[model samples]
Target: MSVTMSPGRYRGLRNVSLPAADTFGIVAFDQRGSYRKMMGAQASYAQLCQVKSEIISALSQSASAVLTDPIYGMDAAMRMSPRAGLLLALEKSGYSGDSSYRKTELIPSWTAQTICQVGADAVKFMVYYHPESGVLAEELEALIKQVVARCHACDLPVFLEPMSYSLDAAVPKASAEFAAARPAIVIETARRLSRIGADVLKLEAPHDIAHNQDEAAWQASCEQVSAASAVPWVLLSAGVDFAQFERQLRVACAAGASGFLAGRAIWKEAATMSSAARANFMAEVAARRLDALLEIAARDARPWSDFYTLPQFDATWYEAYALC
Candidate 1:
């Protein structure tokens, strides 16, 4: 089966010289609590140092450009290294329950300014879970166009990560139930986003692993996503183990996904290491994983590997190094 996507929406980063069919990229970062969360840079600040090192090391070794988030916020994170090419993970304006703050906050303004600050080297500006906030598509489109206009005014690139499925904002919801229902809903949602001027789309893989929820069902959903999306498709890492993760990667690639925007998996390993050592470790594993995924992206057939042949990287490594 052949899958396809629209390529006209990508911006900011330098174009991959590789053909669209052959090009697949990796992006790794932490968004929870990195150096950005802590104010003072103390010797005892082992946590910040470790995460930063892992990110730096990963950026240096891999051909894939790393997209860094403030983890907490840019001002705090940048105290360590402000010059890195970063994707300002712009928080949606109204979600914080402070409409007044949205107007005055650093996110909308600083994101635009930073794009200009970076100029031609514009790092991507990504917004997570925009549609699910109960914002109308027309309203969402206006906000996106506003951001895009701001980016254009500053000559920066904009990358919008839209989900193929919608989720209820009400808390205390059942995650497993949501996971089970997400696949079917995403197909139409993907189509809706394509029409709304989204520059890029990031979607979750299907959760059903049994015959009733087999890989083929997910592949079908991927086909739907690719067909409906007017922009490029990048699958998200759903925090599965290496075997399951690789399977998802293959499904995405076979369905014509451009690449992925991955987090936790890369940084989880360095959470416990010293700042410098963590960076070096993440760089190596990220490089290995990048090569492996790219190999999957370039293939015409899905090659199921023997689990024994796969490298031994576990959840502990992720907690310590993969996530922020």
Candidate 2:
């Protein structure tokens, strides 16, 4: 594919967000509801921030960027000084509606200007989606377009994450029927959302994890997702185990994924350990996972530059650039 080098502001910020040149090894610490569910009664504000800060501190140095929530990790990320660039989550903690038709909402009183002013390199908004949701799908797509316009206006890249859920109440995600159809759902979701103009995509595994164990199927599904996405794309861990996620990452990278913006598979186990052990795990085990992921990504993953090359310009180029 040919690359387009556009205005330098957006290009530069996008490059900063991907520390590994054009590849992504973003560490997603922005999770809320699931983070609480895992910790149960212990999911206090203090505990959440602590976990986010600690593990992020341990892992951020290796990641391309850190995806943080406004309420918790953003402050710590700005203060503690991680080596990675920051990508703030614009969506609220969880989605509206049930398993049938989920809708995502932005965090109250937050805007693209807030993200740019806070020195974030990118904005991430995740919507639980299925193109078949009709008006609900339109609503989510509208929100994404609004976010993309705003972020691009601010010269910040937006990483759109479109999560697929079973719309049929009868055929839940755990059912065999749902698993069989998940690949198509994810690919179509990518195809639909790609047209919204987000700079990067952080997507879930296209193939079903529990029901499908075939490596060939995994590779084919990932290739389809890559082909469907017009922009660059990365893999998300999606609460899978480390070993399984590693396998998925390998398949995805080889099939044309830029890299990963993973969370649970890399650090969830640390949350369940004791405080001291948590610190140890973050420094040792989780840190090693980051290394492993980075190595895989650097080796087999496609670069975001594959989609758009960074702008080349002279020092005086800024004089002509608009900053509204």
Candidate 3:
């Protein structure tokens, strides 16, 4: 079934412009410092751009959209794959200088109008969120309100991603305590962010198999997240291996997720390969991985448009923002 939306919302959705009759499949290459760590000491900004461009050229052919970061990869992405829908990352990472918990900061130069002028399909911000993260939550919420208002005025869609990290330096990132606390944190974060008017949410899977392997519990957690979100929500890969993420996506889609906006999981292995082998790996291995995920989404994921009630717009909304 199709959803009716306000003119502004419609314009935003149209900007995403996935293929007809297919699930939303966004290939995200928007990583910054974290990605460099993944690539080890040899990583350079130039190499990162080259690798991202290669992935877009090879994998975006079958995917719905591609997410790029303005700092390094946006130009190459747009140049290499002009037809793919582009979502530009608007935040700078590693603001906190701590490995355990990152604090996100918006890029000083990009604004809603600037992003739209650059032909982005949407603008995305990644906020590091946790209930006990001191004053960070308040700071992020204020920033989000400004972003949402500006995007609405410009008739551009805005995606909000709230990622949970442990604030305690003593706690190991992969510890059971961290995993156990994640589902509830994720659910609350979705609800709070959605209430502030995010057009779309990029969420982590509620339960990790390493800590919570019960299928029933996984379904229950996923249900809570789905119920909490006021707008359409998609799953993020969070650097899991491809096979594990495939399983998580199957579960998440069955529970209520719209689709996925994933990175790393689809191409991390390619990053580790020798430069001579990287292109072939992206064309053969990474492209196939992307296609496989898209197939799962087509067969099982919900359409984002189906998640919300249709909005009614008065004549002025159309006059001001309607696409001609």
Best by lDDT: 2
Per-residue lDDT of candidate 2, residues 1-324 (tens digit): 645545633554454445545788888889877777887885788887877787777777778778888887865687544567788899998878887979788888999889888778778888898988899989888888888888777777788898888888999887899899999998998898988878778898988788999999999999999999998899999889999999999999999999999988899888767789998888878888888998898889998877886577897988866543
Number of colliding residue pairs in each model: 21, 0, 0
Q: For each candidate, what TM-score against the reference?
A: 0.67, 0.93, 0.89
Q: Which sequence of candidate numbers ranks them by TM-score, best first?
A: 2, 3, 1
What TM-score does model 1 achieve against the real structure? 0.67
Give one digit per residue, the lDDT tens place, for model 3 in 57-170.
776777787888887777666775556777888887656657555667777887777888887778888888875665777877888898788876777778898888887887
TM-score of candidate 2 against the unseen true structure: 0.93
Over 4 Å off in model 2, which ranges?
1-21, 79-81, 312-320
Which pairs clash inside model 3?
A: none
Question: Order of all candidates by lDDT, from best down to worst?
Answer: 2, 3, 1
| Residue 321 lDDT (model 1) | 31
The TM-score, computed over Cα atoms with residue i paired to residue i, of candidate 3 is 0.89
Q: What pairs collide in candidate 2?
A: none
